[model samples]
Target: MEVFIRHQDKNKRKEEAVNFFIEHKTNSYISHSEIMSGRAKSTTEWSENFADILSAELDEDDCNLITIEDIHNKIIGIAILRIYRKYLIIEDMIVDGSLRGMSLGKKLMDFIHNFAAEQKIKALFLESGINNDKAHSFFEKNGFEKVSVTYIKTLSE
Candidate 1:
């Protein structure tokens, strides 16, 4: 399938991209039991909050929302890159779960790399959830190294 990668048109595509992502959201490859044991807020509230945060990032001057589309103009993937003092951080990236084995992700990474080069960024950074082995492998294969482990503690209010 022919794919086009470009800066996301916030007005035209943000909502569609967000919906697609929420539908396919994963626990980063965690086991079923682990996922079941985890503390998750009401799905409705979580999704609402996520959408708001994502929208805000898209509106930020230092963030670029990149999207990939099929020839039919359907959005297949979305990525948000935030510029920082030392590197370009990939805040979020999601590809349609139905298109898993396809090379759309590699294409998106190549696009990001090229964009970073153009902006003279010396390094790129991102974090994959602790249990997301598929994501870990993909990132490793794409030349990302395991530099640190992020710890998380869910607090109850």
Candidate 2:
């Protein structure tokens, strides 16, 4: 499979991107209560909520899209980025669950690094839950060091 990195129009690809993240959050969420308790919560972010946050913080020029398109023009993976306050953050990344172990994620990250380089970006940042070991490892292998930790405590049930 071949991955294509292009600037996807929000109006055109909103649903596809939404579905991808929603699936990621759902499929990869921490299932066991022992794990989801304490400081480790499931990485379950709804797509509509993400879309609202993105739309609020990012202008049209501040966002980008990367998709893995095969010969049939089907998207096997998707990655989103946001450039804000002189930092580039990988807002989300999700490959179709069935397409895992196929290196599509690598292709997507490569495209992201290349995009940053082209823009002469100095640094990049992303937030991944502890449950997402694969994603955290992927980012580390891609040269992202965890500079700080993001802490969250549930306030209500």
Candidate 3:
């Protein structure tokens, strides 16, 4: 199977890609009780807000959203990125569940690395959930280091 990666337009197709990512991301938390519990407490508002933010990010000059499509033009992966003055950040990445072991994530990361090098970016950064062991392993294998811990607190009004 041949796969091609390109910048995706902010359209219905992009929305589908976002939804696909959200589904997989959410499912990944089923084994992590704390995160899944928080997710289940949220209403549709969370998804709506996330979509708005993702759309806004796509409109920023320093941010990009790329879709990986199969030969038949079906979007099988999505990558969201932001390039800053000194570094590039991968905000989100997801591949079709069935294609996990096929090196698609490596392909996407390589694309980011090359693009950053072209832009003279000095470093790359990303945040993976603490409970996402699979993602952590993948990032480590791709040369990412565990630099910082992100702590979150839930506040209620």
Candidate 4:
């Protein structure tokens, strides 16, 4: 499969990415029980707000939105990076579960690294679900070391 990695900050693209993320959240990794468990925090509303904020931030040069399109020109993966005072964080990383293992994920990652080097970013940090072993393995295979364990507890549950 041929994939093209693109670095662009367009609203249409950002919305496409956000929609894809929310679509996955609704079905794949999250169950209804888990969704209800986080209702007190209004996780869904917060996520919607976040996507809006992120979409609005696309115009900033320090924020980036990246996507990978297959030969058909359909976006199969997307990632977003944000630069802060001390670190460059990959805030979003998703490859359509159907399209995993075709190296597109790694290609997008490489693009981020090259872009970061140009931006003179020194350190990088990323967060991923410890439940997603495939994602963890991919990051580990790409030279990301275990930084620290993150714990999450829900008060409403």
Greater TM-score among 2 and 4 belongs to 4
Model 4 has an lDDT value of: 0.69
Candidate with more favorable, higher lDDT: 1 or 4: 1
Return the clash pairs for model 1, or none: 28-132
Q: What TM-score, computed on C-alpha atoms, does each candidate reach?
A: 0.84, 0.74, 0.80, 0.75
lDDT for 62 in candidate 3 is 69
Compose the digit string of candidate 2's lDDT tens values, residues 31-98. 33313332223445333345454444334566677677667766677777877766788866778778
Candidate 1 structure quality by residue, lDDT tens digits, 89-131: 9877889988988999999999999999998998999876676
Rank all candidate structures by their lDDT, best first, as comma-separated numbers. Answer: 1, 3, 4, 2
Which predicted model would earn the best TM-score?
1
TM-score of 1: 0.84
**Cα lDDT of all candidates, in order?**
0.75, 0.66, 0.71, 0.69
Index of the highest-lDDT prediction: 1
| Model with the higher lDDT, candidate 1 or 2 | 1
> For all candidates, what are the clash counts?
1, 0, 0, 0
lDDT of 3 by residue, 107-141 (tens): 88888888889889999988765567888899999
lDDT of 3 at 157: 50
